[model samples]
Target: MKIPIQLNQENLQEVGSRMPIPDYNREADNTGIVHIGVGGFHRAHQAYYLHQLRQLGEALDWGICGIGLREADAKLQDIFNKQDHLYTLMVKHSDGKIEPEVIGSIVDFKMGTKDPEPVIAQMAHANTRMVSLTITEGGYNFNPTTGEFNFDNPDIQHELKHPQDPKTVYGFLTAALKRRREAGLPAFTILVCDNIEHNGDMMRKMLGTFAEAQDPDLAKWIAQEVSFPNSMVDRITPVTTQTDIETLAQKYGVKDSWPVTCEPFIQWVIEDKFSNGRPDFEKVGVQFVPDVGPYEKMKLRLLNAGHSVLGLLGALHGHPTINACIEDEVFKNYLRAFLDKEATPILGNIEGIDLTDYKDSLLERFANPNIKDSVSRICAESSAKLPKFLIATIHENLAIGGSIKFATLVIAAWCYYSDKEADQNGQAVEIIDAMSTDLHQAAEQTKTDPLAFIRQESIFGNLIRNERFTKLYSEVVHKMYKDPNIKKYMRDMISIE
Candidate 1:
């Protein structure tokens, strides 16, 4: 089957057999939201949801104008621009079923590499009522353990120097909000859709700090007027590959320049607080509540924490994708035992969710064959991820006097995997981290001294002081060096429960 033409709005109607398209009356809709980090997850999740709203003739004005701040984003910006800010979202089912749709929630895109002025201008527009972000875990510019904005980062330093022609999101946002304050316009609802715990509050803190450094008056006004609502979001969207683009054209008969692939599951739970009005997201499957704290903790423990357990071990074992790790009985059992014994006892309850059911569903999603979620993807930014996803959980378990076997094992795996001197199957280990050079140097020292890695008080805090965690973590790392048969070692460990 051949697509009649390329996947632009003009040709959306030609691909009806594949699935529906946003062929709605979208010409009059204004851009009410400017989303930063318009990557695969954004396209597969939030943008997809907004596209659904447009399909139902609701909240048409809440369209997204995508913004990309990094040099890497320029290529994506070009692809999105060529496709008229439209792309195909292919839902990959484990049972070998594919559901495809041409999503059109994004009406425009701006790359900060070209010029930050236009992107800031879009945010300053009165019609833009909100600015949503999916800037990943590290983009927040904060030290995970200290929970302080890393103002010393080179990017932040540059942003501080040139506030007007800002390059970082913090710089652009400060400039935009400053304009709004001067013009006597109401501040936009700062909706942060990232995965970190208390993401909205984190954004408000970091962004506000940036503003305060620039203008104290603007910071005060923002603190008084702006609303930052915490939210919980879940989706298994993977990085787009060339195969995804080809598959869409060959199998689905739609030529999408950049297509997102993911499992057919998504969720968004938001706190019910927004200044200057907001959309009724509850009208379309969103959960609006007075508080999203309990819900956030539930996701952080089960989903995010579970990913850390799977990711480090899988990458160290040289499993290319997460599904391969899940296929191993030992790996699957490890996930189940860790969640059931180590994670769940402390997770407690969310009002509407069944804890057992949610855990089972999460394991199933991890094993979803269609996702092809790479362990490296999760393993990236370990310098930042471990503190939030694993260390905090470890500390929580420690404080509550709960079991930490699996959590300790996760730490051991990270310590071993992060080593610059180690190799996975004769191939040099690839360490992707914000502090890669520094982390690798420190990790290299641990190749001989197991406790050397965690001694970085900034990363592990005083967990090194705890005799219990130290003895277990050291023993595991030592065994990793002594035993060459990793497979049997994993089996024996996971057999504990």
Candidate 2:
């Protein structure tokens, strides 16, 4: 059956307020903040916040122009077309409660491959104040091993060779800024919403690297004029399913075909810097921090790392979803012990939030039954996520002689999980990380020398050289593989006793 084009809003069964689209009568001119990669996370998190601001009668000029780089996401395109650029945001809560919000932050959408002209025009528009990016970590064409711009990438090479019709996200951003500079438009803020450490600094570095490789003067200008505000954004939005669409229609009476589903928790912390103009995003729950470092570390290390640890391990242990993983007695204990003993002590000062309470809340959020977030999804870019989430935490713990065993267990779990040929149910598991080949090789070598097996630079990075962590992790992995009663081993490893 063809899904209805509109949500039957009257028949909605959820408990959240239907925010009447507020009077955005203050018709401000089209000032561009070209957002690259309008994915599920953007719709659920950043766009939802913008929708809130719009609802409260602010940020009239804070309009977003979305650009999709690849053409494979025809489903998203079709849904937008059917709804006239509208969709539903179904927020899943831990308490079996649901909040359905209508998000309207995205005003325009353009395909980079097909409709390059409009996308480029919007990017170069005189009033374009910022270029916000939600492109995945790999989207920047950064080297998987070094975390630097992958200059040799064919798309990047094409972009550098043809600046007028740039293809890559970094290229498109720089080319647009170059055009603005020629038009005497002041440089715009480059807001980065990726999970990289010092994301703003990374953006500037990547742009600088891209431009310097192309033109020295353009690189110099970007270094001086661009504002790359470090930010931390968090929300657990799963890939939307057909069930989501049916729920929207049957429960809420809304007819959105491409409704987004997400966990209730959301956070955005921005460094207070804007060149041309910026939305009063602060007015809509976005914390304006003087230094976002502490919070960034907290979120990446605690929340994100927590997700990574559970995700791969969950998949390997026969749990289908994150909710199911946490329900398992062993994983639950592992997570609780991890947050309390291994993860929390390494955390330094973060302004306004209590560590204990924060961690407690995070566990509750993880245990949210309504949100069927899968372990495989969070494990998508474990290669990239591990550095930002796990490795740094390990470093901090090792430096202080703090307990890192539970954290090590998480890493060990990932190693075992990654090595597995089939999923828990005997289905073929897709290993998506760049280090998959090396990891598989190492996993096979584990029978001979577990420590030596993990020394692969492709996955473990330099941390494998640290004899102490390597030994501990190897011992844990050995125990896990050797144990006859795997559930007992998991429980014993996680137990404080």
Candidate 3:
């Protein structure tokens, strides 16, 4: 039996030449980016870009200092502490090839759950030019439908009452920015790396709202001095399983306690705006655009919406993973039709992108067998996802007289999935959402009141008011409840105008 070498700074040479480790020195004093919510996606996407840049012997000072706000992040902090913040990124290609590389961009990690002081201090540091976030869709503490910041959030309320000891992301940010301003240092640019439309703008609004409540002067300073650049980030990073960890140790002879596995394809498009200096990411294939609106819209509508369509429908049909759903001819065809007929038409001319090619590529990416992207993972946060991904498309199409038949069916499927909480095969389908209880209750009322699910005004938001949409949604819900032939329904809906 081959002894697995522990992944750390000291054992870098012992890991052998097969896996690529950081060639350049990772110095703590050179940390320029303080990123919050250091989860799988951020590591695989943003940090990977920096790793590539560092490999070219550029942006050596741009090392990332990852922050974990929740108590659950203690595990990550422990792993990073042991490995010297080094972790493996196993890239799984569609054809069953796996490339393992140790990424050294994250030089340090701070746990804010126990004490927010160090995290706050790191962000306030003059060397820290930017603070990026991948806190997921629901992390921003905002109403998805209304586009309003949720001040009623307990964390936000606590932070407002006691700003000295921070709780939420906004609290940490406000505290850091306040410290920076008080010390006569420039504010760090807030770069949002989440999968929301106009993420940067949204961050600015939420932070500004929080800051304004804390102190009007600080709010004005943040508004004038800080820069929030909107960005569109894409990469299919599935949750790492134990099998992945064991494979790394057994095959590559490297034991990574918490490694990130993702698909080969990755893309980052950002608006070229920053309060402070930034790394030369343009050289690393990061698209620096004048406006990320078109790109963001295209991605949110197609790639993300497509994922939701497959996820909700796939869950209903008892498909375990994304690739499994794609393997089904009906599911594949349904996704294609939705993209080509519904999602694509509503997306106006996206500069330098062929919609046809992009849509085709999405199917190929989704069908990657090695990734094993779970239906449950994709379905985890439907309440947050559907509003931005699918419903937004439906809203736009409704205004423009475009076909929403495909998108409507996905929502209807979601209602079914939520209500049944069991797949067609009688397997208990886990309904994981912030509003799961509410969703289940609303969906259960579909028997007597077909419009109950859509009537969640906070989520559906006047979606129930649209007579055409309600009619379509009601008919689909009733049909689904009667006969849960998901694929058959998909086939019938594919040809609908």
Best prediction by TM-score: 3
Q: Per-residue lDDT tens digits of candidate 3, residues 295-363?
A: 998999999999999998999999999999999999999999999888888878988999999988999
By lDDT, who's the top model here? 3
lDDT of 3: 0.92
lDDT of each: 0.82, 0.76, 0.92
The regions of model 1 sitting more than 4 angstroms off are 420-424
Predicted structure 2: lDDT: 0.76
For all candidates, the clash counts are: 0, 15, 0
Between which residue pairs do clashes occur in model 3? none
Task: Give the 10-residue window scoring lowest on summed lDDT in candidate 1.
Answer: 420-429
Q: What TM-score does candidate 1 reach?
A: 0.96
Each model's TM-score? 0.96, 0.91, 0.99
Which residue segments of model 3 deviate by more than 4 Å?
A: 495-497
Candidate 2 C-alpha error for residue 458, in Å: 4.3
TM-score of 2: 0.91
Sequence-dependent TM-score of model 3: 0.99
Report lDDT (Cα) of residue 54, candidate 2.
82
